[model samples]
Target: MPKSKVRKKTVYTPPSSDRTTTPVKLAGPTHPVYIAVMLGMMLIGLAWLVVNYLAGNSIPFMATLGPWNFLIGFSLIVIGLLMTMRWR
Candidate 1:
């Protein structure tokens, strides 16, 4: 087998410090209603799963949904978690 040739690495160049940048505006705190909705989604998802497990067969609509109930429940939770990324 032939040995591979070694290549020289390029030198790192520092950026020029002469560029002026505008100050970034800081975002205000998230609204109380937004927090409430985010928390509500997660709580609702948990409640949905609990209800599905506890009485899935008893509820007419829940019985019809069958396995889809799991999807709906998990989706709500994931959406709520995603919303938290923008909360600040």
Candidate 2:
């Protein structure tokens, strides 16, 4: 009887040059309190408009100013949103 020969398989190794050393960083604002305060101010302004409307009372100087408060409130909200997207 003849003896059979065995064969071994070759293993694969990754190169060290393909590895990454730096960590990934996120992009955005880090101050939550400022954003919260801006949002709160906007909400308060909106609430004032609603309350005055329901009470059938004309907002002070609204007739002359022409929706100034609403515009200011909306601007505040937009600023808050922008600040939230900024990096700290």
Candidate 3:
């Protein structure tokens, strides 16, 4: 009598986890808060630009700040933009 050979198959098993993949949480300002801050900065920059444009020398304080007045306004905008990057 010839004995029949039988093939054995192994089943694949997946890893067990309590939870599935989830999105990574970012640490920073919320959307609305970030937007508000950004907008405020933009408005301030705009106001500074306007004030300086209108009065080139009348603002005595500007004379003390020198070229920093322009820098301050531009810096605010830059900071806002940087902050926006952190927004989630």
Among these predicted structures, which one has the highest lDDT?
1
Measure candidate 2: CA RMSD.
6.4
Query: In model 1, how large is the Cα lDDT of residue 87?
Result: 100
* Candidate 2 TM-score, true structure as reference: 0.43
**How are the candidates ranked when ordered by lDDT, highest leading?**
1, 3, 2
> Which has the greatest TM-score?
1
Q: List model 2 lDDT by residue over 1-88, tens digit each.
A: 9989888978887666966779878666657787577667667667755654564246556555555756765676666566655536
Question: Residues 1-88, candidate 3, lDDT per residue (tens digit)?
Answer: 9999998998988878867888998676477866898889978887887777788478898767767888888987788778777667
Global lDDT of each candidate: 0.97, 0.63, 0.80
TM-score of 1: 0.78
lDDT score of residue 69 within candidate 2: 54
lDDT over C-alpha atoms for residue 44 of model 3: 88
TM-score of each: 0.78, 0.43, 0.59
Q: Is candidate 1 or candidate 2 better by TM-score?
A: 1
User: What TM-score does model 3 achieve against the real structure?
Assistant: 0.59
Deviation in angstroms for 87 in model 2? 9.6
Instruction: Give candidate 3's error at residue 9 in angstroms.
Output: 18
